[model samples]
Target chain A: MRTELTERFGIDYPIFGFTPSQEVAAAISRAGGMGVLGCVRFNEASELDEVLEWMHENTDGKPFGVDVVMPAKIPTEGSKVDLESMIPPEHRAFVERTLDDLGVPPLPDGNRVDAGVLGWLHSVARSHVDVAMAHARKYGQIKLIANALGSPPPDVIGVAHDNGVQVAALAGAKDHALHHVEARVDIVIAQGYEGGGHTGEVTSMVLWPELVDAVGDRAPVLAAGGVGSGRQMAAAIALGAQGVWMGTYWLTAAEYRLGATGDGPSTVQKALLAASSRDTVRRRIYSGKPARLLKTKWTDAWDAPGAPEPLPMPLQNLLVGEAHARISQADDAGVVAMPAGQIVGRLNSITPVAELIADLVSEYQESAARLGKTLD
Target chain B: MRTELTERFGIDYPIFGFTPSQEVAAAISRAGGMGVLGCVRFNEASELDEVLEWMHENTDGKPFGVDVVMPAKIPTEGSKVDLESMIPPEHRAFVERTLDDLGVPPLPDGNRVDAGVLGWLHSVARSHVDVAMAHARKYGQIKLIANALGSPPPDVIGVAHDNGVQVAALAGAKDHALHHVEARVDIVIAQGYEGGGHTGEVTSMVLWPELVDAVGDRAPVLAAGGVGSGRQMAAAIALGAQGVWMGTYWLTAAEYRLGATGDGPSTVQKALLAASSRDTVRRRIYSGKPARLLKTKWTDAWDAPGAPEPLPMPLQNLLVGEAHARISQADDAGVVAMPAGQIVGRLNSITPVAELIADLVSEYQESAARLGKTLD
Candidate 1:
């Protein structure tokens, strides 16, 4: 499959894979699509810098991208202790109670959670940009710096452009995309409500075309949300998206498990593998914004009566960081908080990233051919 | 544009337009797509039979269909009085309070809201089927009968088949479609959450392909949701839908305003035409089940804190039926409760039904060509 995105990036296909694992990102790049490594997990620029170095060596000279959590409206920057203090006591008590009820053990000695909200702060995102610019100048391997929440600030966009790197931002609504285009972002990723993580109320079927029409030629539109297969890719292209920005489908990739901290498939991956499309809920407990997540016991608890309202962005993450770490360590699939889309129904097995990309390409081809036949 | 639905009905395109107006339905059928008249508004079989007669005369010998709300599990059949009494006083008070707050006028002298829940009664749906079967046998214009809620009872499906009418049912998930296929539903419409009226939680982008895969060869899948443009039609086809089952787009048809009881465009139509895709809310107030509707003051009032929870199905309709009539008569666009999908954003102008159908055909062709070019 080819489109404006493929031509712009000189990639073979119009699929852009977003994953937290550098290995999965590199695999997607080597397999002819852009693999975007999510940088939000890194607490410090040095950690991200080391990961980018590893990506530069392992990507086989192919271009890959990095995604960072940079809110358009910058939040107050502070130390971890200061951030933790902002979280309400009631909210902390609720999290502690839920984690205890779920039987999630405390972190082992010397494993305290730190810098949980650092990536969310504007200062930390500036550091992330500094690291990305350095890699762009040194090896010319950092081709894209994508902002996960919305458009990066104008100065950040300017810095990326000056460093010869493209900028992408996620918009869940047409008006937001228009603002992104106005902000002069290089690419607009229109993430619909059915997508994993942060999203808006509109579905992909309605949002993709609306954004394409609204953005016009100002920026290329990448359709995200519930796009797991080649048929879905064709649907996105048919709706005038230049490409697909997929994240949830990559959570089950074999390489994702390899790069994960655990020895075997994590609970998140297992839950995703067994889930149907109906097994997802759009809850605000994830990041204080509406995000589609697996309908796990943990999510259910937050939605249950008497559960405290989740705080805003960085605060919500701060409140739940330790609980998340404990749940991950507990290795129970029922209560782990994993951001996934309705497309979880289609991803039933753990395939290698390359195989998954190949399947998408073929499925896209078959779908395109099928549409052509219908026209005939 | 040829697919199983188009070929089965010998229509030129695979668009199935669902509208409550006989004029709009006939116009769609005459313009090369099958227009299915929504029968839920008719409280009596005689009224529906007369409307079918009008449709038979107006459709220019083209095949048409009718949609009836035959809930899979039939609700307790009751008289309007019985249904009215079942609604609690608190729910009735909430409706009255909302109407008063919106300043909606009560019905004028000599007018009364009667049989509001009759069409929703299982007995009424059976009568609807009887009228449709009669038309199928007499005129052969009633080519398809679609059940709006899940699969029709086996006896209903058998009756339609005996009368040589094909049966279609709406499903929001793969398992629901599978049950429909097992019940021998001739067509399965995968109605996504973005669809208007009663709907399930899954969006079309994920649900269509899931239903298609599950109902493979057992029944053809017709995609129903936020399909407003030809590009959306192409997307639906690419995702394995045999055709598009559209409803919300018809609300703005010029012919609809002609049939509506108003001097000009009704308040509901005005609200729909002015709405953006983001202006819709999925709420249970429209029906007892979650249905997408225009974000109007009436719906907002119900969602507000201190508002009584909407009762289930017939009871909800009974409680709010008079309030709906008052809102309609008051001609206030801001407070009307109208079922509409996110595609309302694209339907800005009141175009003729034939012109709309023609545009969709050309758009579908263009989108298919666009996808072909991408493959190159």
Candidate 2:
């Protein structure tokens, strides 16, 4: 399964797994595929520094990356309070009424409503980039930085290159890939509408080839969205992608199957395992942008009639942050939401990261052999 | 690129091109790929029979197919008059106002408004099926019968199978493919959201692999949507598709570039040639269902504020049929609409069907070779 991407990232396999869990990320790296830790949940520079330090200590010198959500056009500017004020009262009232109707209880005493709203804003995301770059310079473990929303600014690309770290950006269209290439990013992850999180309407089969034909020679393109198996990995390579970027496939890894003390699967993990690909819906309830999330009462409420349109970006994230936090704290499966792709249908079991990687490699080999027979 | 599909269909390549033009369909079959003449525009059974007969005589012993749009769940069930009466007054006024605004003059001479309200209603489409089957039995030249909206009804499938004609249906989701297989479809064309005309939210890359994994062993799956290159064909095959079903690529073929007298491209063809992948929008302006079409004044008008939502299925088709005829007759580029896929970005030049098929084969070979190198 080695390709130009494996050589570029110095990994045994060219599978790039994106997740927020440090354990899952490190385990993926140890399993010979690059695990990219999402930094959007880190509120403070010190928190991100701690996560990076832990990853470095745990991965045994394997390559991993950091993902930051910095959209090219920030929805709002100035302080967090200013952005909060920009949200409409109707939207706020709808969210509150919806949460109340869902019968979600308030947090317990002494528990703060940790909405994790830090990296959603542009100013905080810039600070995240600074912290991650600084950690990369000091530890030399973070090999790549991926901007999830849009092309990284030229300065970020230049600084990452200067620090001996490569940069990647996710694009859902051919034009977006071209923009990333023009910005001089080292890699472009062509994500389709079927991908988890925020996505455009373009699907991976169409988006992958368009991105490859547009900028394959200029930069290595990593195929993302709806990719969950070895056959899909082989198909991505056949579509001219140097590698495959997977996110939803890792949510059910064994690391997430149980707590550190070995209790049982978390509420979110349980929901994912019990769900099918059709269980997810694309709505702007969690964030202002359309993101795929498990279809829960929270998402259904926002889509119902008389519900206000979601506020743009940071504002929407701000309005729903506390509701999400309360839902998570309550641990109610019917109301809890998780971002996932259409491939979630096939994610029926939890396995160790190493076993998953091995299965992927084996499946990829088998698929390639089958396709080879077609040519014969 | 000989696969089981090529052998099963007795064609030179595993490529199927769908178009409404008889000339383009015959040219595609003559060039080794199967040309499927879309029968949606033929209102009468005799008209379809005449066109099928013409295709039979001109294809030089090549195989061709007939495409019928009989949705599995018909929105309306009565006669065409009843369906026409079901259209709301506001929708009719809106269409009239939009067409008046676009400066599309009425048809010349004493030509009455031939709305051609044949394929939208269930009764008309049933008539179409009867005509196609009778023709198939008499001619023995039509090798395939494709249902665009859904799986062919059991009687249709049975009849086709009895006449030695294979039945194919288009699916945009995994469950849809399963349903088609349950209905005993011979082939499933898994189309993504990026495809032209009516499509579900699922994309081709995600949808293709899911469909293949679902029913590939039971029946052959043809990958559709955003497939305009040989590299994409190779990728689809790698994802487990037996062949590819293409539609938008044939819109700008040499057959469409010239009039019957070889004057110039039609207004619709010119619009397609000048369009980009991003220029298309999925709207219910023409049909009640959401379909991808070129973004023009007609589509944009319906998107404006206070515009009435389009009626369902046959009602919407009846309302817009005359307006479309007027716009096409006027040859106004701003108001003329045509169904297209996102791959329009790559359809910048027009070539003969033979040359296009040759290029696709060559590209498929090269892509397969490139993928083989990765496996090595």
Q: Which candidate is the best by DockQ?
A: 1
DockQ of 1: 0.87
Error of 1 at B243 (Å): 0.2
The stretch of ten residues in a row with the least summed lDDT in candidate 1 chain B is B109-118
Alpha carbon lDDT of each predicted model: 0.87, 0.83
What overall lDDT, based on C-alpha atoms, would model 2 receive against the true structure? 0.83
State the C-alpha RMSD over the true interface residues for candidate 2, after superposing those residues.
1.6
Candidate 2 regions exceeding 4 Å error are A75-77, A110-114, A257-262, B75-77, B109-112, B257-262
- Per-candidate count of clashing residue pairs (backbone under 3 Å): 0, 0
Native-referenced DockQ of model 2:
0.59
Q: What tens digits encode model 1's per-residue C-alpha lDDT throughout A169-284?
A: 99999878988888989999999889999999999999999999999989999999989999999999999999999999899999886325666676778888889999999988
lDDT, candidate 2, residue A87? Answer: 82
Best by lDDT: 1
lDDT measured at residue A232 in model 1 versus the true structure, 0 to 100 = 96
**After superposing the true interface residues, what Cα RMSD does each candidate give?**
0.8, 1.6
